[model samples]
Target: MMRRLLVVACVLLPLPAFAHAILTSSKPAAGGSIAAGHQTLDFQYNSKIDHRRSRLTLTGPEGAPVVLTILPSSATNALDAEADLKPGAYTLRWQALALDGHITRGDVPFTVTAP
Candidate 1:
């Protein structure tokens, strides 16, 4: 009876929930530089994400933030986009929604150098 009660208690207890969607890697890496012109913007997370609901915002040296259209991805944990850029400082802001319903946001600051 005691063993059965202990098992029941364990089952009733709430399990600890793990947080989701940490940014693991990015193209034009943070504080890094990339060649100017057409480029691929990629951001990878630690877990699967909902690309449909995610956002990618890019702010250029012109001091304007433009919402970049995210492209369809074969990768479940990465967000991909494309842009035509000039040699300047830029910030890629990302908001990702994980499959588990968690949202994570961050920015990648990088420079675009003359090709």
Candidate 2:
């Protein structure tokens, strides 16, 4: 019957809410500190992400947000970017789209100390 078929289809389909990527770990960690100047930012996720579609935004000491360039050689489930920071509070906001086509985002707030 149509009702039974509809129920089956719903059961078979994967839930979108559960397929979103989660930040498992990150370099310079959240609320963590690092030295000023050139640094590599890394973000590891719970699932494989589309590096080409993912984004990393850095908010520097001046309170302006800049879109970081994603490194080409980074791993599938990880995002890596390079940044030159100054001594002040900063935040790295990231957005990732997983293999399942779900997008997830979060922020990493940290401080840049004098080298």
Candidate 3:
């Protein structure tokens, strides 16, 4: 009986780990660069996220944090936004809440160059 219960617990414990939202990829990929001007940001996650509860914050070269608008998503596991960038360094901080009520956050630091 103990052996059977241990096996069940092990199986169920790993399931919750899969529900945490993890940033799998990004548009201006971390440490990458983009052209200065209107740009679209895309963030892909490993699990389905609650878009309504997620947030994206952008910090420009001047060190001011601006909250970017979260656009409607066609893909359930991705978040998208838009912003007008100037030539400088920038960091996009993302906070995502998974369907299972877990919150995950990450940063994508990139630079914008004059085009």
Candidate 4:
């Protein structure tokens, strides 16, 4: 019975090699505040992103949408864009290719104070 239990546990346990995507960090830090009319918006990922399959967007306080594209280089996989944000709240929604080839996405909110 103990040997059978051990085999079952091993089968149920998470694999040593698994793949997933997560937001390690972000500028403005989700619900953080910053000056309005930001020259650039940034999103950082914990793992490498598949640029060809990634997408990002920034919505203004007025609900206007600004699309951000992928920027992959030797150093990092970052999504960025320039915006003339107005003083108010904004939303950032992002989707990307996980290391395991799955899609992962989430939304975050932030505020842009009037300069």
Q: Pick the candidate with the highest lDDT.
A: 2
TM-score of 4: 0.73
Q: Which pairs of residues collide in candidate 4?
A: none
Task: Go through the candidates in order and give the C-alpha RMSD of each one to the true structure.
Answer: 7.8, 5.3, 5.4, 6.9
Name model 2 segments beyond 4 Å from true: 1-18
Full-model lDDT, candidate 2: 0.87
The local distance difference test score of model 4 is 0.70
Query: How well does model 1 score by local distance difference test?
Result: 0.84
* lDDT by residue (tens digit), candidate 4, 1-115: 8757644654576343324457777776798987876456677776677777788788876677777755454224566556667788888888877545556898879988989
List lDDT for all candidates, in order: 0.84, 0.87, 0.87, 0.70
Residue pairs with backbone overlap in model 1: none
- Backbone clash tally (model 3): 0
Compute the lDDT of residue 33 as modeled in candidate 3. 96
RMSD of 2: 5.3
lDDT of 2 at 105: 91
Better of 2 and 4 by lDDT: 2
lDDT of 2 by residue, 4-113 (tens): 66445545775643356889899989999999999999999877889999999999889889999999988978999999999999999999988666578999999999
Clashes of 1: 0
Give the runs in model 1 whose Cα sits over 4 Å from its true position.
1-19
Better of 1 and 4 by TM-score: 1
Report the lDDT tens digits of candidate 3 across residue range 1-115: 8757645664477574446788888989999999999998999998888888999999999998999888885278999999999999999999998865667889999999999
